[model samples]
Target: MRSGSASSEFSRGLIDRSGYASEKFAEGYDRHRLSPPPAVLKILTLVAQAERPRLVVDLGAGTGLSTRVWAGYAEQIVGIEANARMLKWARRVTQEPNIRYVQAFASNTGLCAGSADLVTCAQAFHWMEPAAVLREAGRILRSGGVFAAYDYDVPPAIHPEIDPAFAVHFAARRRARERLGLQAGSATWPKEQHLERIRESGLFCSAREIVCHGFQEVDAVRVTGLAESLGGPRTIFGEAAPEVEETFVHLREAAERVLANRSWPMVVSYRIRLGVK
Candidate 1:
């Protein structure tokens, strides 16, 4: 595994720079690339019954992880992103003959009307204004097309005590933010309530939910990588700050301590919520 600073071309000191978080986040984003839930493919399989997608659009395609997942199914896939750095990063590392990245916000993709067979947003819907994004999705999707948005929250758990340990660890981070007079990041709409919002958008019919809970066995280093990769703590405290760097070490230590007592493999559990259109 490469160290976080392996890409010296991208400065480690600029994580909070305005309008460039994605680029800043892009530097180390691949080091902690996300794995979507198994249900994601299952949902897409259901969508295949309607018609195997021809053109797919991936909104907020950070580093193109989810976009790559769609590549095999679609002849053409476009990844839309608001951040230039992230777009460049995705194009560089996730390039496929069928995949391309465009600079655009989720709310206004500038795509031709009814051009897409499917739309996907993963781990990024919370960063958007869902109503506007849904409206835009409604515009670009063909009549029978599907729009799916999904996210997984909370650090990967290493069994019974890891989640509790992480709660305490992050709460302390929040308190530190309070001490600095920096506001904590607000919670995004809960997965349950978001269903109602999706239904009310009047975009597409038959709104549905797919929930997945799974665990991955990991070590202390993997835990630390996951912690450092999240943009929240890095953006809030600034990754270059000594305190923020210290928190990563401490978070890893906390995980190690919590998992030592369990004979079971150190497992990180994640819950994924997928909203279908």
Candidate 2:
């Protein structure tokens, strides 16, 4: 198959399988999932306090989790998502009158230039092509508007009992990607090389800030569900990796045991970057 056709097929399969995984795991996401990490919540609150933007744009507003955070503060909040299945779930969960969800990609938001006072991408930055997204974000933001990108970094360690399960899960995912001819690189895409690309775009005032924060007392079941729902594992395993299911079960059981003993908080870290348009 041509590269484009192969990519399209891969993406379609990935999205369809992800929708199934999410549906199977939806309750856990809603009930046990941690709210926005502290750094992300702080950034949103800071923007709300600073700009109280009349019109706010949320790119990659997956399942409306971030959209709900800003719905009360912004006069009007527009959530743009590419995945129809996710947008459907967002519509059902997000009922705020000020929030409107659109089916669109981050590269081309279908929004007018200079129309928004703030544009935010929460926990979904790596999924985007930064150079293209930066230009699009710059176009949609009013002069002096803020652009924020916030995401978390998985700690290098896990609790002793939980660590083995995650190791197996990750190993299976790597094998799956290899089978599909995908490359697994560092958590940061385009690495440090892309920082200059963003700065040189001249779309935003040349300044960068990295805000760090930590989270504890996270529910274990929520963590498991979030990892499984993220599409990486299922995309790779494709029903062949028994270890994936076994690891999740082990993790879930361990979490329950830890929760019963009131010793279940997991330490997590995050970073947030903001610039001016």
Candidate 3:
């Protein structure tokens, strides 16, 4: 495994500087952000079921959305996040007794070595430096402990009528990233490559992807909220773009029009990778 210093430097640049925009988007992150697809929940449930971990550490645990689910099965759940505002909301919103929230970066959790039964990062793995995080996670876990990383793969289509608009939404996001000087990469964000690196690091006894699916019914209001939570259209527009808002409003209105006469379901795909040390 790579030394903590090496991982820390890489992660600090990737997360603290390059990924800083994410923190700005956190306030509105939950609103338009799609829920964890069913596949991810199932995998998480399976991990909790199989491990029945006494102590679980949730890395990059934004707002405790994933941690809340694990809290039921794990004897104790510790959520570590770097963003203070998000951590505050996570602490405020989750009332689970077994769950504790900490403001800390995933690259360096500060927890003692060999103390955790399981370590999981949901939807936030791309934001981390895998080599560093994997090393730290391995150090913090007892023998036979598990480390899991999971994220959703948004399908190409949202809805027949709204599909084009969703395309525009993504286009706007790409433009936003470009404006911020971020490089464009594949949709998967080096996931497979990172998994290979983790395997090569020899920190895990085994590692593989867990497949899962999710379905949800999104109304206009909920969709609007989700968009807002994701940095409010402003993140994409730089300044509020009336045209983008109009597009989202139109999409919502179209959804309403469809729902008034029929039922529509949105399906999401997810991949969860689990590594056991």
Candidate 4:
């Protein structure tokens, strides 16, 4: 295992700079975020040719939502996280003995070299320094190990009207963040470039992308909860702009009207960028 300063070029001090280190944000994230689709685990495990992985590492594992899903699939699971508040919640809720949380940056996890059979970044690759994180992933993955970064499309497919309203809220949140000069908790990258980063890292023998969808039954609360989990409206950065709140209200109203008091099924599209070492 690499240790000390040579372990990573990315600065450890910048871990939680993405403005999502607050207690409220972590709570919202854990409560509302959907777990990674089951196909992601099966695909990565298949590509790695491992029926049951010995070790799996989850990067930027906020609140263990992504990490805990691997408990039955791997012999050991390590969730690497940097935010103290998030880690606290993750530890409190997790019950699997095979799963453990480590407070560490994704690019500098102090895990053994070439030790992981699979490494994943769920809904979190964009907040990392891509090149550095990929290098660390390669270093920790044994030959033939798989690296996957996946994120679900937000807002999901609730209702035609409600979905567009959610988009309005999304745009409003981005505009607010820009106006407030607030950035994510780390150096952010575009999620679309995940496959490119993996292939360009020169560590993977093969790389590809897979798209799949999962369905979940949701109510108005979950709809709003999904929006709130993005750390908007009431984030550590303080209250969002009036327009942001207004747009969110519109989304909520739409959700309430469209779904009424009943739960409806929604489709969550997931994109998985995979690499095999």
C-alpha local distance difference test of each model: 0.63, 0.63, 0.66, 0.82
Q: Taking the tens digit of each residue's C-alpha lDDT, what string does model 1 give over 1-277?
A: 1122222212222223322364356756655646664556566657534445778898878778788877666788989876667778888887579998887777777789988877887776655666777888889987777787766656555656566655555665656556665432224344545667678887776776666554455655556566666544365565434566565666777767865534334433333332344
The estimated TM-scores of all candidates read 0.76, 0.77, 0.79, 0.91
lDDT of 4 by residue, 1-277 (tens): 2242433333343443445565477777778778876877888888899999999999988899999999998999999987777888999899999999998878888899999999999988876778888998999999999999998886688889899999989877777767876654322567788999899999899999999888888899988988887743345335547787788789999999989899998899999998999
Instruction: Write one digit per residue (lDDT tens) for candidate 2, span 1-277.
Output: 1122222333334445444335534444444434455456556546535546678888868778777777656788998876665677778888799999887767677789988887887766555666677888899988777777766554214477665666666566656655654433223353343345557777777547565665556456555765565444453455766666776676677656655545455655555566677
* Cα shift from native, residue 50, model 3 (Å): 3.2
Clash count of each predicted structure: 2, 0, 11, 5
- After superposition, the stretches of candidate 2 with alpha carbons farther than 4 Å from their true spots are 1-34, 37-41, 44-51, 155-168, 182-197, 214-217, 232-236, 261-265
Q: Which stretches of candidate 4 lie over 4 Å from their true place?
A: 1-19, 185-188, 236-240
Of the two candidates 1 and 3, the one with more favorable lDDT, higher being better, is 3
Q: Pick the candidate with the highest TM-score.
A: 4
The CA lDDT at 245 in model 3 is 62
The candidate that wins on lDDT is 4
Cα RMSD to the true fold for all candidates: 7.4, 4.8, 4.3, 2.7
- Model 3 Cα lDDT, one tens digit per residue, 46-165: 654554678889997877777877766778899988766667777877898999987777777888999898888877777676777888899998887778887666432347776566
Question: lDDT at 169 for candidate 3?
Answer: 57
